[model samples]
Target: MTQSDFDDGNEDDVPEWADRVMADVAREVRRRRKEMKWTAQKLADRCEEIGYPIPRNVIANMESGRRAVLPLVEVMVLAKALYTHPLRLIYPVGYVEEVQQLPLTYPVDTAKAMRWFAGLNENYQADHRMLHHHIAHASALERALFAVQGEERQRWAAERAIDDTARAKALRTQADFAERAARAKDELCQVRSAIAADGEPLPDLPDTLADVDPAEGYERDTD
Candidate 1:
């Protein structure tokens, strides 16, 4: 039999562990391909360009968990072509025993506080009340200072400048509140590293959350 035909042995010859590993690899390959928005043919083309003799049928067999043995060279080539680590493609299933799970405590909902503060200005009546009370009070003080003359004007200007500085500081505080609130709502995933049975912990997660801004407002991008 040809080497390719010999390589494609009957299912019974494969060990259970090998079968599991191949299955995991197949699943991961399919997942990575889909994540990269590449078709089987596109992946094959990329492999060909990278000097790896990977055909569409070979890709299909690998993804279908039929061709179990993956050479290190091919793994490296595929990983480079797909922008991933070679180890990621080979050992897709992480040994849970090797992973260190940390105790995670969820933080209090700061976003709710910000939302509540924002809602205060949502209604027209509430807005009008703020305008007449807080805003008008401040404006009145500004007008009073501007209306003065000579030394009184200078003194009033200094006082008004202090008020303006205070108002600016308050606005900055509000902005920080908003930022912290938005950060609180973000979905977080933390992975702790652990020493493997005979290897080191893989630094990268299979999937990750990326920051993306929503068209309308700030949003936490996650996959």
Candidate 2:
């Protein structure tokens, strides 16, 4: 019987924790593949269709724990082929309670680990430099715009509502989203001002936000 690479290696010769995580990933891959009712050949076909071909035997080895390494690129391409997010396969946020995210650290809350992996951890973002903060604030404004647009869609849907109460509720949601957009625009202006104060060139606002006065608090010269 051929032993798994990890099983044959000395403790110091292998990263046991990493191999264990790979085993977990192997299980997940098999599970998702089976759930989709796809054969290994079918999965390989999908990988090729998506422009990265992991041979059927290679995928079989990965699923059987015979493959010692899973490359980052393969992980990404496999994710695209499997119709799932790479992070979901890597950490499995809601499916597991905890995960050992690093070599030496204790197991972390799975959701927290996933968030950190995805660069969504608030504490990590808090330590970013001013330019990152500026980008984040700009993203917030864009998200607010999307939120308002979604609310507008709901309001439009309310036009087809048979009940006055449903229509009123949708209108209220639109109003609330509009208020949030206004706040986001104000925050964006502040971010631009701070960037200008720091001697950085302000980025152009999105066309939807063109009406916002980015230089609102700065004094202008009157010749």
lDDT of 1 at 6: 15
Q: In model 2, which regions exceed 4 Å deviation? A: 1-14, 130-135, 138-187, 195-223
Candidate 1 residue lDDT tens string, 10-120: 454345435544555566678888999999898889999988868888889988877968666776777877888755664443421111111121112323323333353
**Candidate 1, poorest ten consecutive residues by summed lDDT:** 96-105
Off by over 4 Å in 1: 1-14, 93-223
- C-alpha RMSD for every candidate: 23.0, 7.0
What TM-score, to 2 decimals, does candidate 2 have? 0.62
Model 2 whole-model lDDT (C-alpha atoms): 0.74
Q: What is the lDDT of every predicted structure here?
A: 0.48, 0.74
